[model samples]
Target chain A: MKFSILVSEGPYTHQASDSAYQFAKAVLAKGHEIFRIFFYHDGVNNATRLTTPPQDDRNIVSRWSKLAEEHKLDMVVCVAAAQRRGIVDEGEAKRNGKDATNLAPGFRISGLGQLVEAGIQSDRLVTFGD
Target chain B: MTIKKFMFVNRKAPYGTVYALESLEVVLIAAAFEQDVSLAFLDDGVYQLKKGHSTKGIEMKAFEKTYGALEDYDVTKLYVDEESLAARGLTADDLCIPVETMSRAALGKMIEEQDVVLSF
Candidate 1:
């Protein structure tokens, strides 16, 4: 089945991001197609490359980035939410006069329209949040 | 594209977190997709519809007015849980907009019929 996931919370603060990551992994393991993974609200924090966890800890950001890279996953962070939380990409950094970009690899900043498009195109849309 | 029944199940209060407003943003965008969209208000989500919301003292942007623009987006299926309303001492008349009051059981069945169930 084609599935789309919506994550609405950031890592560490809530289990929504972890649960979404696990669920996405399980779906891929089960040989299901993930149409998209949309990050909204605080969930956009998962796309920042600036996160540096302890060497012993599970780096949630890297986990998602690697999964997205391996699977060629369409990981999208809402532009509005990302801007509000300072998750700017290269283009946005230049446009908004920011010093540098922090968007992690394998994730693109997009509009909420991507989310609605996911709902229309995918067979199922699952949301995880507080 | 398939016409999916997308239901956003809101169970949280507004302002404490960004869920309510962010959920509304999705709904507004979903309108353009022309999917069958519905908004279910249960638990503390019922408070989102209460009339006369004041965010002045809270120092937050009062988005209660945004709810009124939902109709313009062609996304108007708003369902409020009857039990939740009664528990919170609110009635349909107290809400910012008109809604269909359904029993929790009925709403459960409705949820079962949805292709996508988004909880916030």
Candidate 2:
């Protein structure tokens, strides 16, 4: 079955991103397809390359970035939410006149339409949120 | 593209957090997809449709007015949990818009019928 996942909380402060990552991994292990992984609200924080954890702790952002890379996943960060939380890509940074871009690899900023499209395209839409 | 049954499950208060407003924004955008869209209001989410929202003191946009525009978007299926409303001392008349009030079990059946359930 194809599934679309919605992650709605930030890393460290919430377990939503971690749980979503584990679920996505399990889905892939079971040979199911992930239609898309959409980050909304505080969940957009997962796409920022600026996230840094201690040497011992699990690196949440990098984990998502790597999994997305290995699976060729479509990881989308909501543009409105990302802008509100300051998670900028090169294009967004240039358009908004910002000095730097912090969007992590394997994730792209997009509109909420991508989320609706995921819901329409996928067989199931599972949400991980607060 | 095939049309799907999309339901937005709202379980938070309106102004205390950003979920209510952001969820509304998604609903408006989802309307453009021409999918069978519905909204479920339970817990504090029932407060989102309550009448007479005054956010001037808090400096937040009183977005309750936007609910009135939902009909124009062709997204009019709004379901309020009856137990949640009764627990909050509110009734259908207290809401700013017309909605169908159903028991939680009935709502669950409706939710089970959905293709995509997006909780907020």
Candidate 3:
């Protein structure tokens, strides 16, 4: 079965993103395909490379980026949400006249259409939110 | 393209948080795909459709009117939970738009039949 995941909360502050990452790992280990992983609302914070945590704590953003690299996952952060939260890519940074792009590796900024497309394409759509 | 049954489950208040508004944004975009879309309002989400919202004091956009425009996008399947409405001291007459009020069990059944369920 193919499943798509929606993470709607930021890391550390909420467990939604962590739970979503674990679920994604479980799905892949069970030999199921992950159609996409969409980050929306505060969940877009997971795509920022600027996230810093205690040395002993789990680095949430890196975990997602690493997983996406290993699985070639289509990790998408909603552009509107990302813009509102200041998670910018190079193009967005240039277009918006920002100084830097903090979009983490393996995640791309996109429109809500990608999320709707995930719902349409995947056999199941699971949302992890507040 | 194959059409799928997409349901957006709204369970939050409109003003206190941004979930209700963002969820509606997705519904509007999904409408363009020509999919079978339905919206479920339960819990505090029922407040999203309440008539006569004044957000000027909160300085937030009064998006309550957007619900009426949803019909123009061919996305009019709005379901409000009867128990939730009653619990909140509200009724169908208090809402800004026309919706089918049903029991939670009935709404759950409808949700079970959907290909995708996106909760907000």
Tens digits of per-residue lDDT for model 2, A17-120: 99999999999999999999999999999998988899999999999999999999999999999999999988999999999999999999999999999998
- Model 2 agreement with the true structure over B14-45: per-residue lDDT tens digits: 99899999999899889888889999999999
Steric clash count of candidate 3: 0
TM-scores of the candidates are 0.96, 0.98, 0.98
RMSD of each: 1.2, 0.8, 0.8
The segments of candidate 2 whose C-alpha lies over 4 angstroms from its true place after superposition are none
What is the lDDT of every predicted structure here? 0.92, 0.95, 0.95
Question: DockQ (Cα-based) per candidate?
Answer: 0.79, 0.89, 0.89
The i-RMS of candidate 2 is 0.7
Write down the worst ten-residue block by lDDT for model 3 chain A. Answer: A121-130
- What share of the reference contacts is kept in model 1? 0.95
Total residue pair clashes for candidate 2? 0
Q: Write down the DockQ of candidate 2.
A: 0.89
In candidate 1, residue A107 scores what lDDT?
Answer: 97
Which docking category, incorrect, acceptable, medium or high, applies to candidate 3?
high
Tens-digit per-residue lDDT, B17-55, candidate 3: 999999999999999999999999999999999999999
